[model samples]
Target: MRHAGQRPADMPGAAGFRAAKWHTPIGTSRPSSRVLPSPARVRGPGPAARADRAQGPDRGASVTDLATMSLQQEIARDLQVSASFDAQEEIERRVAFLAGQLTSTGLRSLVLGISGGVDSLTAGRLCQLAVERVRAAGREAEFFAMRLPYGDQADEKDAQQALEFIRPDRVLTVDVKPASDAALQAALAGGTEFRDAHHQDFVHGNIKARQRMIAQYAVAGAHEGLVVGTDHAAEAVSGFFTKFGDGAADVVPLTGLTKRRVRAVAQALGAPSALVLKTPTADLETLNPGRPDEDALGVTYDDIDDFLEGKAVGEAAFEAIARRYRLTEHKRRPPIAP
Candidate 1:
């Protein structure tokens, strides 16, 4: 099997979907109309029906209205219950602890791919804290933040923000356009027809992610440092990441936390409020206004994480996630022997 750092000849260009912060659609926590029964009366007529009609349509409608109200109330109650269980504090502590552990591993320095997303931001912060702890102990610790862009100006902007936040020993920017274009041309030459908008998006998005991963690993090797991954539990659970792409990391600081909790940890760590509040985007498309990742994946991160944690995933949702997860589980694991 090809190692995570190696880019295959047929690999497409760097144009993966951008990461964006999530905003739950309006009324997501509320009961939907599907929960309510139809207000229309039954057309069928019979003596038994007529006898049962003593309750009248008004009574039935009233009952349904009450039931609908109760359903909404119940949904609200459940949401509150779920909200109460957010693992923000726990995740933050874990990340902080992980940072200490990494330093104790006798590593000289830390390197990370700073994408300006919550995951990367959280990882960067933890690395900074870890370096500080190591410095306090009279040990040498360094942080390098690399900004790898694939012909995207927005990526430059995000990288700049990350640079300002982390203030690493050195900030490096590598342009992957040459490699990306080569792969894209190869894909076109192979006569791989782009079927629709979705297919095109998928192909392009995977290319960008894989390219970034390749660049990150190359830098890690040159610096003799571990490559930090920004993947979170939500993305991992739904297999939303590209294999050997963003999934390639020497150390994953936030893999155990959900997207929602990741945001909270970022906020708690004094990350820029804007960075915490901004919608997550992978910054793959510099020209086009980026779409939310969940929109592209057709499911919310909250639902994905819930299912991964052994909560109820409906039959349809369960099958969808299960298949994707099984296929992508390889991305989450170390390389196996043949």
Candidate 2:
């Protein structure tokens, strides 16, 4: 079967979704209100170097694959992608963690952006659950779900469904297209020019991502809440997030989860099965709207999950994913010191 990276959304996507970083909307930690967001490909090297991973000098296949496999296991340990865990236990652990943060910091609320995608949908619901626990302990806490759309989102109905399930204490909608356009114009008016429309769209998409975060932070500032990010192991592995855009947040609840594992938690929380398994995308590109993230990475989410779970994927997919982890290390780290 074709993976999410190669298949259209109307068709069934990959059997598994990797929790990718916020590159686009979906790769931004498998991303908000939705599935994984993708990163803009322009800022770094384009696609994976297919030629690099070819049979390692006639070495046995297992030996040739050792480095890649080792890296995968290293990351898996870091992210805690266990071979097994009860979904309910996962939910309880995460909720307690959120509540603990609230009690310790004295923050009264948790805020998240609802993308109507599985990532955001799941995160939003978790926020609601956490805050509810805090309140039950005689503390005053609340969860606010923001709808930061860029004029219109492709999966708005799905976003609404996520809201219905989350039932957050507050819902706010802010149209980001206006602010995003203004920023793009201001950047161009500085005598900067793009080589093409694709480049222009890439810049515009990143601007939109930052703008969405700005709105979320603003709302969080106003409400005395911490911004909750949807970051998880799958997205983190790919570094698919938009650095300081979807990547910046006060709290990230979904760390160490695979895409399917995130789905498992959402299912336990009673999210509709269909929504939990919706096609994952960053949908960040205006040039190719609603594009599957797999297309951008030149591999599928299944490839990512397989790699993360220590299962073998095709050489092409394996190399592409490993290359992303190496190239995007900067995205996952702090600035260099003097």
Candidate 3:
């Protein structure tokens, strides 16, 4: 007779099969072999076992896809665009109402950092509108645009374009080469080595950004005006800015809008097409040139914003962003105490 949990030695389909060893709580023993069911009967067959079948393949998207995806995901998912229209209108109305607030607060002028990009251009134009409103209310309000170049000649071109576009009451260009060089020398003296030209380029870029902030604050103080920030919600959420550098401001005019929305609004306001379409760069260079902002960040601003808005940015995209921004996170927020 067969024992418990043991099959018969001459079981069916066991003529050519060898006995297999079995381990139980009692002891180890060999049991008669049994034929196993086919894989299709056990696990079933439906989809192919391929990476693309399981997780979808990403062969890189087109520019239109990238732009549309970013905007749609951020507005629809994170901000809930349908429910946000009223809130957005209210924010615009409040911005218009700031004319009265400025008057009451004894502020007469607005100082803006005109980077010639969509954000800065939008902020400059919006400030111009607010200044007009304030002036209409019998209050003196002026818009001062400063083009502070850290030695990049290409940036000077963009800055000049912005200056021509805005026609601010006062346009000043301050070269921050001396300050940037001093900072670079100090940083390198601390044993921080540059792996290549790109690394050195980034260090110089950070200097340029900080120098521009210093110049903006100085101009704002001199003119006794509120320093307007050009930072938008997308950059804020992903921490894509310099902390006390470009991130510092008295008031951020475009803080509620994403970078994509900023471009839309800028286009709506009739900003220069060339300036609006230009790839953003920190404009830090004394000699050759540097890579664009997207190149340094590994991912585009649109992609970063989309991920922040709760869209599936994919593991590869996320890793690219993490690798880039993780190292520069300190530039995005206030220094924490150890």
Candidate 4:
């Protein structure tokens, strides 16, 4: 059988769908987003060097053959060949799929936090389409986009643009600062302060994420809705989310897609270009506004995309990505128990 990454020339795509190209998106992380910068660059073997190493001094395999095999292995292990997928068709399918999942649960509404980021915007549009599909089926459906700002968000403009584009059934802005402050106060009760000043951003950021979840669930329960999440393959592969925070959700519509692919979906779904092309940011840190996700992850999204696509990357990046995948394996799984 052909591997999933292998697409025959005659392979048929989904009805009314055709494969397309990949578009790179910027990656940024906040102190609270838990992303660290990608590993620094280091001198690594070029294609010729890798081919020589693979052939070892005795093998007769051509360098081209070795390189092709290496690329295939990498794609099999990491990348998904996202460009082979049709964005328009996938978005429609996800809309229907989410609708079906919600209908099966006897829930007719969806709730999500909109961060004005591409992931959230794309997922928000999906939610709107899902709800529309459900309603078209003669079932009652609603989509709620909640803006959970910590206080005054510098990037609130982006969030507003997304809200305008999505135009969900309802728009609610809930400042999470009060709740975050309460949680921090409770945690710090009987203690004078945290160990360090900078540590507060981390603690507060986690609080903000969890608080957003709390708000989403509350709204969902009130409206008999399922919580929607925006987690996707790129973030998942790198374990770039917080457990029980943004990670906790009733359903995720954007999983199984790389960050670049997610942007394509956003564009296909009519997401505003400004929103689709907006540099990614976590908006988790209050003091340090606009902290790029790459700065924390120590790697650029381009490299991450390349690594995921099985393209040759620097040695340091390859090792760093591998190490992160291994370390974050636990994040991708359910809690262990005997």
C-alpha lDDT of all candidate models, in order: 0.53, 0.68, 0.53, 0.63
Candidate 1 per-residue C-alpha lDDT over 20-109 given as tens digits, one digit per residue, 9 for 90 to 100: 112211111221223223222211222111111222111111112343334323333322223344455555455566556556576766
In model 4, the runs with Cα more than 4 Å from the true position are 1-83
C-alpha displacement of 316 in model 4, angstroms? 2.1
Off by over 4 Å in 2: 1-46, 49-65
lDDT of 4 by residue, 220-316 (tens): 9999988887766667555566556776777777755777888999888888998888877665756656755555454566666666665665555
Deviation from truth (RMSD, Å), model 2: 8.9
All candidates: TM-score: 0.65, 0.82, 0.65, 0.76
By lDDT, the better pick of 1 and 4 is 4
Clashes of each: 16, 43, 0, 14
Residue ranges of candidate 3 with Cα displaced over 4 Å: 1-91, 97-101, 186-200, 285-290, 308-315, 318-338
Q: What TM-score, to 2 decimals, does candidate 2 have?
A: 0.82
- Give the Cα error of residue 80 in candidate 2, in Å: 3.3
Candidates arranged by TM-score, highest first: 2, 4, 3, 1
Clashes of 1: 16
